[model samples]
Target: MSTAALITLVRSGGNQLRRRVLLSSRLLQDDRQVTSTCNSSTSEPRCSRFDPDGSGRPATWDSFGIWDNRIDEPILLPPSIKYGKPIPKISLENVGCASQIGKRKENEDRFDFAQLTDEVLYFAVYDGHGGPAAADFCHTHMEKCITDLLPKEKNLETVLTLAFLAIDKAFSSHARLSADATLLTSGTTATVALLRDGIELVVASVGDSRAILCRKGKPMKLTIDHTPERKDEKERIKKCGGFVAWNSLGQPHVNGRLAMTRSIGDLDLKTSGVIAEPETKRIKLHHADDSFLVLTTDGINFMVNSQEICDFVNQCHDPNEAAHAVTEQAIQYGTEDNSTAVVVPFGAWGKYKNSEINFSFSRSFTSSGRWA
Candidate 1:
């Protein structure tokens, strides 16, 4: 494989692109029918999405940083084998996602979901560091590994833990077979959400990417970001004979290399407490007033707070549009990293298609209204 092929490998298809469009603009009824018209008969439903193609440049994307040496010389790669299939079925009851390559030449973000059964659904987001390989690998293989190990487990947390470590070990085996030491360096953060019975949500996360729950329009955090700057993380790194400090970029990193202490494939940093163990959380959904859930990488979280993000999502009835709103807001706020957002709505929020609603986001933390 060459660099161009590698780029295509990771950047090509969304398999779930249709689901994003469907859920981002329409609402699923109790009877399994979807409607975008909501309760209004006068106005047309907003179905347009914010897709970044070769079109007009977004003002937020700085013009100076979009090229790289890989454009001319495509590096040769070893023969590749197809990864596990994307979840055979989609549980598009109420889920949405949006991602932007931002100023980078290649996008390292990947997200998808699978409906294991009628009542069980799995969602994931992977943010790659160093390159898109690790992210793509996790996005393609993590859930498959999870489902394969599902029947043997009784505890959700234990299952999630096993799945993550299993992926780490599989990647290690692949690296050895391919003789690709680079795989050990290219790592990604994994954030997976499991929705059982449509009301019970279990999230497993490693690294800075987060999952936030919006209950009655309030932001409730579900996962803790695994950054080296955190006190416990810093102490743990020290215990492992590693140091944490701000690099020239003004960001914290362990051993001046990897920033997040926990990830899927950063094998080089694993000795320094950079393990793949994921933190898990369970959330019970309330149908009357409880709203959607938002999962995003640090790109969005760095620019927007949980409260403001929840407020923005509350304004968009469609989860995809909600995700787009979050990412667009992050870019507008000048978040330079590649941004991605996943919105999963339930209960009243699943059908709150108030078409006339529009919202503006705040660049800084003030309070939580739609008036930034």
Candidate 2:
């Protein structure tokens, strides 16, 4: 994008960025290091599938391969209740991730899902926009930043908010350190999903990487895209002294540079109304139909709609391979960008319909029901 560098978070309510600058220069595409770091998955409430290349080639620095693997699971969540009766203990069934670099010179995407404690499950996706540095930084440090500020009393939503803002602040500090520190304009979108106390679901997001909740074969969108074209995001940017303009083909960009309005880096875009404040959404697992949760980047969602994803998951032979199915489909359908997906199934095969399922986003949470 346009590298017109002068920007600030505080606006004077004046037209500091002229409209003429939009046409001054063509948007330059930075040929970044195809970093394995998924740029980012950003949003207050947030939370991928896939391989693009058909070679079954292994992951490499330049190109090719699938990095699909299962994460730690079977951690027990505290017991809950159903219909005023105490429910039995709950544990994870499975968690899996898959990714493909597609046509890019190098893959700049990264993903991970881990069981933080007996009761908390953490998953993340990073879709880097400008370069790999921001995504790498997030993949490496986002959780640490969040956990360092979190209190023991359990304010999950507030912790999410602080965690996102912390990354922005930390990145800014790093950028100011030296001219050679990092790309001041590099940024990534990040999505983080938390399943806590076995039942509560909290999604915090910024940027485009999306999360979906599947229930009885139906798809429920769990995050909002932070692209500049969205009405609410446009207004938020304008209020912060940033202006949205259409590039040559009518795609929206903030200050004629960045495509997304919210992220963890792109320090130059901060003053233009782009921010890292994620909008969070909370859900309590109360449906027996709440089959599983799918996390993916734009590489998958950009090519397929919500229903298609639902149907794909519903037909999976194994929840462990759900991510592979999603990413593999994304490539077959034509996704030129990096693709990644994470799947978290509720219970075991043939046992889901007969399992206990109760979860809430609030302080007081409970759930216990047959899986099927």
Candidate 3:
């Protein structure tokens, strides 16, 4: 068979198998969109858009189209924190899944913390490659990593460096204890940011996942994807027993299995010297910057650019709405993988705050409202 034909067959089979798994998993909610069709003869439910164009054969059955069954439900906003100075309102929405097998269904893609006192907002997105374990691990531990590094008299640069190193160490330790190869095999890309004192923002990342800062109606990428096809990445991969291959798009990949040069976990791949160290960057937050931060997996990036997402978000006043819109757009564009997003608006702090406070005093008061 021709290479194209072979590839199509493989994809079709994979899709069919995935559809069966999703239907049987029973994890999807009825509200979620699922593709379906009616059989001409039996009048029963069949595959919708599951057939390839002009193939006259079922391309494959896939539930939720190219998206994943796992979705990130937004955390309820506290009334007190919903409208306050420095962090008026923050919201998050995520959808998508990892490429098949060896990890949790959904990769951890968003994390945010709004602190009114410090006027600091922390947000992050992790894009897992091999599995969800590494991504989820980062999601749960990132806050701890930052807190540990920040309170120790370290500068933002130093703190970000140490935090990423610590994250890798933590993942390695956990994987070792589990004695499960899968844990070690799973890896993820991560990008994080901290909006500090409403004056500056710090960002850091590793792997292909991206972080973009939309400022003044323009998108500025904060992190670089450490793909193995780059000159430096190729040199490193070569030294580590891996070779880069050029795809039809002329993009390079490591052993055609992975793309990024650095990532968290992937113990087996790390043996060749592909460490899990992250590259970090920082920027100042400005008043003229009607900016927002967007962090997402490659799945979303595959179909839409950072500027495109930012433009869409800019149209919507609410971050939650913006996130949903971006996800929907990704689905419409035919991203055949899990899609997730987190949109954080800049310069909109102070809208979410508590209107009342309760206090008590032990001393008795006179009729004149004087304490006695």
Better of 2 and 3 by TM-score: 2
| lDDT for each candidate structure | 0.69, 0.65, 0.59
Give the clash count for each candidate.
0, 54, 13
Q: What tens-digit string does per-residue lDDT give for candidate 3 at 1-372?
A: 234423332233233355345444432321122332332544434333333242434322121111121221111123212222111122223211222111236534544453423434567777776767888898788787787666674367677778888889999999999967789778888777776554457887888777887766677898888987568877988887877777886887777767778888887777665777778888865433445677776767776777677676666646666677777666555554566777766542112222342211231122112332
Residue range 1-372, candidate 1, lDDT tens digits: 335533343232232343334333322221123234335333543322222242422211012111111011111112111211111112365578999976678889988877765556888889998888789889888878878777888567788999999998888777667666687788999999987655567899999999988766677899999987789888989999888879876999999898899999887787888889899988766544556678898889888889888877777757788899999888776676789998876544633333353344344333222333
Which pairs of residues clash in candidate 1, taking residues 3 or more apart in a chain or in different chains? none
**Model 1, clash count?**
0
Q: Residue 47 in model 2: shift from native, Å?
A: 47
Model 1: residue 243 alpha-carbon error in angstroms: 1.5
lDDT of 2 by residue, 1-372 (tens): 011221111111122132123212211111122222345434311111112342323222111011111222222212322122111123335666888997787777888776666567778999887778888888888777666655453867777888889887887887788585447888888899887765678999989999998765667899989888788889989998989889987899899888888988989888888889998999876423466788899889877677777667666656667788888777766677799988876522222332232222221111111211
Q: Give me the displacement of residue 173 in model 2, in angstroms.
A: 1.3
lDDT accuracy of residue 172 in candidate 3 = 91
Question: Which is the winner by lDDT between candidate 2 and candidate 3?
Answer: 2
TM-score of 1: 0.70
User: Using Cα atoms with residue i matched to residue i, what is each candidate's TM-score against the true structure?
Assistant: 0.70, 0.70, 0.63
